[model samples]
Target: MKHLRFYFDVISPFAWLAFAKLPKVIEGHSVTVDYQPVLFAGLLSHWGQKGPAEIEPKRAWTFRHVYWQAHRDGVPLQTPAQHPFNPLALLRLAMACAPEGMTPGRHACEKIFRHVWEGGGDANDPARLQALTQALAPGRDPNSDAVKQALKASTDQAIARGVFGVPTVELDGRLFWGVDALDMVSASLRGDPWFDGPDWSRAAVAPPGVVRPPKGNP
Candidate 1:
């Protein structure tokens, strides 16, 4: 059986869409998926980059594109009451649901994703979060030091794996990013020779024609 690690942050609608479609994408294959919840903000900070929501025009385009993609893909998605809200609570809650030294399972991940994307509600509302906490019945305290540390470790691990974004799938040490890469993932899972071709290696080693200067220097 193949093991696939899905790294995500609920702050991203693309992650929600990818999570919803993943089961169908690997239906016939014997694949074990590990749902990993990491902080999107942490990733952005580590990479010295801003999220789509942080850029005004890209933020609008991102929402519009995701909604259209979700509709086309038959995945249910609703924008939360706010964009780019703090996801620390949800991330910690997910980690708290896992057993010691393990990641959260699909049930916990689905519940959290649904809570944010299925209803047009405030994901961070105090009452709603309390209700969600009760519903999850986490084995550990979400706010506990251990849970927070675990979440940080998970994000650090992701960064070490060269993950700079959400909704990434790691299979056999190959990283596939974006919801649109589902087909590529499926192909790889089926042992497609395209992955074995020279193009894959060549693309990675391709030289950049121009270099952008540092912010202050430019």
Candidate 2:
């Protein structure tokens, strides 16, 4: 059986969509999935990049695109009461739900993701969070130092693995980013020869034709 690492942050609608579609995407394969919760803000800071919601036009487009994709795929989706809200609480809560020395699995992660994406509710509303905490009965304190460290370690590991975004599936040392890559993931898992071909390696080695100056320079 293949082991797949699914890295996600609840702040991403694409992460929620990917989580919803993952089961069916790997239906016929024998695979174990480890759901990892990482801070989206940490990733953004590490990579020196702006999030989809940080740019006005892209934020609008991202929402539209995700809603369309969800509707087309028959996945239930509702925009949260706010966009780009802090996800640290949710991330820590997910880590807390897992046993010590292990990351949260699908069941725990799913509940957290659904809490943010299912009802168009305020994800960070104190009452709603309290209700969720009660429901999960986490083994650790969500605000505990141990839980915070665990989340930080996970995010750091993801950074070392070249993960620059959420909803990334790490399979056999290759990082596939985005919900749209699910089909490719399935194909690769099924031993597609294309993965071993020149094109895959060639694309990575291709040199950039144009280089833009640093943000403040230009």
Candidate 3:
């Protein structure tokens, strides 16, 4: 059996999009998707990651690329608010639902992702997160005792792992960042050529300090 560690910030639209498709993509593998909820900005600061919107050329191309991908996948692609609040509460609720195991974890994460991106609901809004929580677990509000306790546990685990970002997949002692890396994660699971070392992994390599090629220069 193989383990796939997934660290993601729920507020990321790209993460939401990736999460939506991941289940199907990994259906054939004997893998466990471990969800690690973390702070996106913190992770970015640590790894020096910048959102496409932060760079003009990157932002323009990314908009078209994301929309086209979403369209191809038949998923809605919305321009989420700049710095769409942190996903802390959202992570807490997901943790609450998964106290025992991932059966509930996947379900919980799915609901949260849908509410935030698909439904365009405000996850940072206490009322909204609570309402959605109630919808999933009868009479259990996000602010309730049960939810709060579970959230604490999840947060503790995150701190232990030194996690602070979304769509961060940890495997083989390596951390793969971003939703776009899912393919590589999947390929690694299947012992694909790239994971074996040439095709997939090296294709994404950039010269040191290349900075994503300043967008259009690629």
- Give lDDT per model, in order: 0.94, 0.92, 0.67
Q: Write the per-residue lDDT of candidate 2 for residues 77-106, one digit (tens) a residue.
A: 999898889999999999999987788978
TM-score, candidate 3, is 0.70
True-vs-predicted CA distance for residue 92, candidate 1, Å: 0.3
TM-score of each: 0.98, 0.97, 0.70
**Which of the two candidates, 1 or 3, achieves a greater lDDT against the reference?**
1
Candidate 3 lDDT over 52-108, as tens digits, reads: 557888878866886788898988756644344666677666765654433246777
Q: What lDDT is reached at residue 152 by model 3?
A: 56
Candidate 1: C-alpha lDDT: 0.94
Q: Give the TM-score of candidate 2.
A: 0.97
Q: 161, model 3: CA deviation in Å?
A: 6.8
Off by over 4 Å in 1: none
Top-lDDT candidate index: 1
